[model samples]
Target: MNTIEPRSTPQPHLTLAQADHQDTLRNCVRRSLNEYFRNLEGEAPNDLYPMVLAEMEIPLLEKVLEYTRGNQTKAAEMLGLNRGTLRKKLKQYGLL
Candidate 1:
């Protein structure tokens, strides 16, 4: 007897606009990183991962909150974050 394996869920499909938005974001990050490295002036980078995340997360949370009209639930849902986590981030960023 052969055992059946469970199939993995299919990835969500992105619309044209979504794809373009992703590409635009990628280009922006690439350009920013290139500029950042150039301006490093032979100094070693430090805490780059957190730095990039903080930089991106601020604008992302702000835009999502604005789009959701200050509704934490909707903003968290859109950002794939828990409502409590969103609130914590808002407080951390002084956006609360």
Candidate 2:
């Protein structure tokens, strides 16, 4: 006959401590952002993503046009696009 010791159950205090720590981190970030913005003394923040995309598209279209030497049909072909579709995108993006 052999006797085995029973394993002890895990405690919940560790899980609660982790949750509290995460809450503290969130509050710290919120407070820091508030303080930083309150001390701002400059121009307003801009939507950088859209602005960058617009700036990039202009040069990209120009380069594609140059590569095709101003030939819309060949440009569309080389770009693997339908000519009319490319024309529409160009017009929509104000590049036409």
For each candidate, the alpha-carbon lDDT, in order, equals 0.90, 0.73
| Tens digit of per-residue lDDT, candidate 1, span 7-29 | 98786898876665565788689
Model 1 TM? 0.74
TM-score of each: 0.74, 0.43
The regions of model 1 sitting more than 4 angstroms off are 1-23
Among residues 3 or more apart in sequence or in different chains, the pairs in candidate 1 whose N, CA or C atoms overlap within 3 Å are none
Minimal lDDT window, size 10, model 1? 16-25
